[model samples]
Target: MVRVIMGVKGTGKTKQMIDLINSAVHSEHGNVVCIERGGKLTYDIHSKIRLVESSNYDMGTFEFMKGFISGLYAGNYDITHVFIDSLTKIVNADVTDHTLEEFLDWLNSFSEKNNIKFTVTISADRELASEGVQKYF
Candidate 1:
């Protein structure tokens, strides 16, 4: 189950995600993993939450993506939900040789094969206008 919640900055996107995480970790007994990229919001979650700081904006795209993917598969056993604070940051940071579309496609495939539900928050300003928009999460 991959979901994307997009909106303009300060439109409660991150806040919405945090709220969702709070509920899932507090009530659903789900393991919530959040990849924080912007160094903006931080909170104390229950025992079910694991917060990983992927970057503070200084890290490039490939580095952040590699770390995020590595962190997602870091441990063993049931992690119910994974949320990336801003998918745009990851996409923009990816300065790899591959095209942006290719990278996103690879990520989509990776998520599908892993059976890990993910929520990617992207800013409205960064949302690309194209047919491939449907491919995101």
Candidate 2:
């Protein structure tokens, strides 16, 4: 239930995420959310989809982002999909950091348990990421 979009900067990773958001919003019966670092995605995601700016809250670490996501799911049970754009940018963590690695491991199980799909975009290529995290992409 967890997917990742990985690439270097300016590789159209966000565009791919936008496509997923727009398409999912049109077909999903439940709510869809796309979380970004700022207001850059306001005009990109579909109007029906909920676009949350991560900078609005106190999020800058893997733990905070994880709890933020958990809180979001708790606040709304109807959410079926969550698209996270530029996770490293929002959380200020290196892609290869162990913190992110553990967080991604948690996300995989969390999404499965909640029956919610998660898609995250990271600004790192496969070679740059650790072997354990490459499978996500």
Candidate 3:
């Protein structure tokens, strides 16, 4: 499943995502991974959970991010949950752009195909986000 945590910037979205990741790591039997722009939250997450810094890789577009996620699934079959903080930052686009919808659609399909859950944090309020994308919030 694909879940979105939508809110404006500086609204503690990262904190919420981090808390969710922590909870998932402690409760779930499978592995949990949190992907962010930098390794800023590496210290905050539990040691058992994987912390991936997206900036270290070449993820300049939405498609690249999707491929990177696909690579993660390819490399780790035990991953049950993926927490992506700052979705807009990683995609380097506004939340209202058409690419957001495309990415969400791809993510939905990817999640279902791999039987993995994705929790994403978008830097936009529910009302500010596109109508089609708000349903995941």
Q: TM-score: which candidate is best?
A: 2
lDDT of 3 by residue, 20-128 (tens): 9889987877889888987789888889888888888857799898888888889989999999888888878888898998898889999898889999998877787
**Model 2: lowest-lDDT 10 consecutive positions:** 125-134
Could you arrange the candidates by lDDT from highest to lowest?
A: 2, 3, 1
| TM-scores, each model vs. reference | 0.70, 0.96, 0.94
Once fitted onto the true fold, the runs of candidate 2 whose alpha carbons sit more than 4 angstroms away are: none
How would you encode candidate 2's per-residue C-alpha lDDT over 1-137 as one tens digit per residue?
88888899889998888888999987888999989987988987789988888888968888888888999999999999999998999889898798888888899999989999999999887688886687787
Model 1 residue pairs with clashes: 61-93, 61-94
lDDT (tens digit, per residue) of candidate 1 on 44-136: 444457776766444456545755575567673467677777766655643223454454565567667766667778776434524454455
Q: What TM-score, to 2 decimals, does candidate 1 have?
A: 0.70
Candidate 1 accuracy as lDDT:
0.63
> Better model by lDDT, 1 or 2?
2
Candidates in order have lDDT scores of: 0.63, 0.88, 0.86
Model 2 compared with the native: what TM-score?
Answer: 0.96
Clashes of 1: 2
Which structure among the candidates has the greatest lDDT?
Answer: 2
**Cα RMSDs, all models:** 3.8, 1.0, 1.2
